[model samples]
Target: MSKHLLCLALCFFSLKTQAQQSDFSNINFTKADAIANKYKGATLESLPILSYNLTSTLKTDVEKFRAIYRWVCANIENDYYAYLKNKKTRNKLKKDSLKLATWNAYFTQKTFKRLLKEQKTVCTGYAYLIKELANLAEIKCEILDGYGRTADVNIEELSIPNHSWNAVQLNNKWYLCDATWSSGIYDLNHYSFKYDYNDGYFLTDPNLFVKNHYPVNTKWLLTDTIIPITSFLNGPIVYPTTFKQAIVPTQPVTLHLEVKQNQEVIFLLKEGNPMDTSNITIEMTSGTYKTSVKPTINKNSDELLEVKHTFDKRGFYDFHIKLKEEYLITYTVKVEKK
Candidate 1:
């Protein structure tokens, strides 16, 4: 059989086996039933026939396939990675090889149900499972091979094909989703599962993946715009002050400021107590005056407050602000220098 035909056969066979093994008695098929009921007028009796008999199904088509696919994705747990990583539980998965070579070899011998029952498989195994489920739901999906880069690391430097994920067609548009990435994995250094789901990476903009992910087949990327890692890492710098000059009277001007991305600021005066709130307030003629301000923390913090004052008298004020944190944040303007 042709490769495409073989893949299709595997997909259908997996679905048939999964349906037979699935314990639907425990599942509240009410939703699925309700979805199926929409086609009550149709003559189809079974799911497979209804799914493949496009002419009849499309007649009552309420897009139940997408619903079923989403439900499965939401319900399935990606625990293989975590299970293999734990020393105590890792032994159980010993039968299931972690090596990519072993996984590639298994796909040739095992069907989806067998691999799933073994509770061990590699990236290809996971992708195959996804394909199986998608096929059952009649959702068009494809497995794409690629390398995933750590947040700051570059994939181009890596020598091995380290990751795999899925591309799903929804609403006539393809999106990338990584179930493995969705599952929190233990970072050896942190010793805890860092559970962060970046939907942006799931079904991402083809342009954005080019800079980080080098798919075996570039066609899967689907976009020409290459977004640099720096573009995502280095964001716009929001200066504390948007204005270089402001009109103020010497009485005592209070400047209220906030920073975005939750950054903290430390206000310093060249001639006043750094901690003294009163000293931070200065009186000058009706003109602009310059004061120096700096941030203390190197990371963004929650919303905070900092107050600066100039008396009713103002002159040309020159103030300098230095970012103490290396994150992008926004500040709110509470007080006006004018």
Candidate 2:
């Protein structure tokens, strides 16, 4: 979702492990929800229905793709409670077949159909469904098999892919999209899905998507520049809205960021242009504690600024890169207890 100037090695995210399903039948999607019906999911039998109802308002190929994607995100929920029995009804059926498959599972047509009828899926199911719908719409799409920064996935754990996204060729330009993430995340604790519709994943910038998703076929990255997996793990977590301008991080942004309690962490910023000094300001805010710091800047030329700070507490602190008081982008830092 973002970009940066210097390529520093530091990435952090967390995810819950595979959870066991439980009773969640009492929970109901609101009646006004588009995907409230059991058959609202994408399926072979529903293709004509979906094509007619969803794409009827669309006039262009791009609109068709967006319509399909919007429909999926609105109606689909990660199948968190599929296996769990509805305690009210004595009938227990295995209608959902999404069993935490590894990176190797092929997105066969059969499995994709099952995901649609059942109304749930992981990353792979999302990829397959999008591809299927895209093909039906005559839009060129590919299932981008890749290694995702799946909740706490470290560099060592990235040997195999843990996720799959989609790439669509629109107007001869290929763009990245993650239907699973766009739809919502699987909440293991609540044993349900959080309906958070995200549009950033659709037609995303390859550089930003590269922060977390590493495609097995690098071509699917759909960018002229590619960042390595190691760099991705070390680089700051970014999103598109995080930056106002394109911040390309090549190297040498940080000397060493190993900060200890009561000690300062030296921070550096290298801008491509030096004359924009009046516009840029770097600040820190602790979301956990609500404390803010505007570090004293050691301006080096118009392009570089060196700053240092000591965080008062150990928690998730956010680094904001701003232009004239407007936050353009952010980098997250984890200050731990000594």
Candidate 3:
């Protein structure tokens, strides 16, 4: 009986995942996107009315959720200072659960007040607003807090829960998304938020999503594939452009690598859509010097992009795969004397 129950559970999980991964080739998002743009700068005071305005005209739950997600991404400004403050506080209070909980409680109230007044927020606010709006529209949604890997985060350890995203159930199937990241990017040089909506974060593939986002609750990882947190922490640094191109780093699993000078390292990226391999190049930087090198790129029959590069000099180098002149996934390697 136990073995039979186990098989039944496994079958159910497989079916649930397949249902969420349905192809939406026929679902045109033009109307849904337009509706979200139509009501730009909408107030958050009456969530029921806001939800109705966003979803009432849409026929499908996915479209309804898309509208809500898009509007939040476009309208909300990410407060970097607020995020930094929260991170500092969380890290400082990490050893004390009691103090951490108190700070979280106080910060939650403070966060919402500012969110309503200034239309600015962090990841938690984005996820919360998405959930509230979706729930009001009679769509099931949830806020998932977890570790979000980025260039700024230390790859050596998973210290604290540093980020939050959302999961919505459309047609009884769960899909993952990140409105905060989709909203825009923070320009460190200018010290301001740039409102550039990244469409890739919307209804993202679970396998690709797990590369950067690791939910605190493993069950929220919609895919059946198991990705250990250690692998995620050591993975390549992905930027917003990485998702825009629908590329996944499949080789050299870890971001930091040690290789002998003159030794060739093969890096691979799986593109969701095939592209011209000629435009791919690598930009290598060491200390104060930087140069661009066109590595030997090979496109296999399986759509896997192979970037083979050899370091001729002994030095620590920070390199990135440049796609159409824009830097994508980042990796670093230490080259020792051959």
User: Among these predicted structures, which one has the highest TM-score?
Assistant: 3
Against the hidden reference, what TM-scores do the models get? Answer: 0.40, 0.59, 0.92
TM-score ranking of the models: 3, 2, 1
Local accuracy of candidate 3 as per-residue lDDT tens digits, 86-145: 999999999999999999999988989899899999898999999999999999888999
Query: How big is the positional error of residue 53 in model 1, measured in Å on the Cα after superposition?
Result: 17
Clashes of each: 36, 11, 0
> Of models 1 and 2, which has the larger TM-score?
2
Look at candidate 2 and tell me the lDDT of residue 3: 50
Residues 145-198, candidate 2, lDDT per residue (tens digit)? 777763246343444445778877655456678877777666788767888776
lDDT of 1 by residue, 217-248 (tens): 65565553433434322322121111111101
- Per-candidate Cα RMSD to the true structure, in Å, reads 18.1, 13.6, 2.7
**Which ten contiguous residues of candidate 3 have the minimum total lDDT?**
14-23
- Between prediction 2 and prediction 3, the one with superior lDDT is 3
Count residue pairs with overlapping backbones in model 3: 0
Which segments of candidate 2 are over 4 A away from where they belong? 1-44, 80-113, 238-256, 259-338
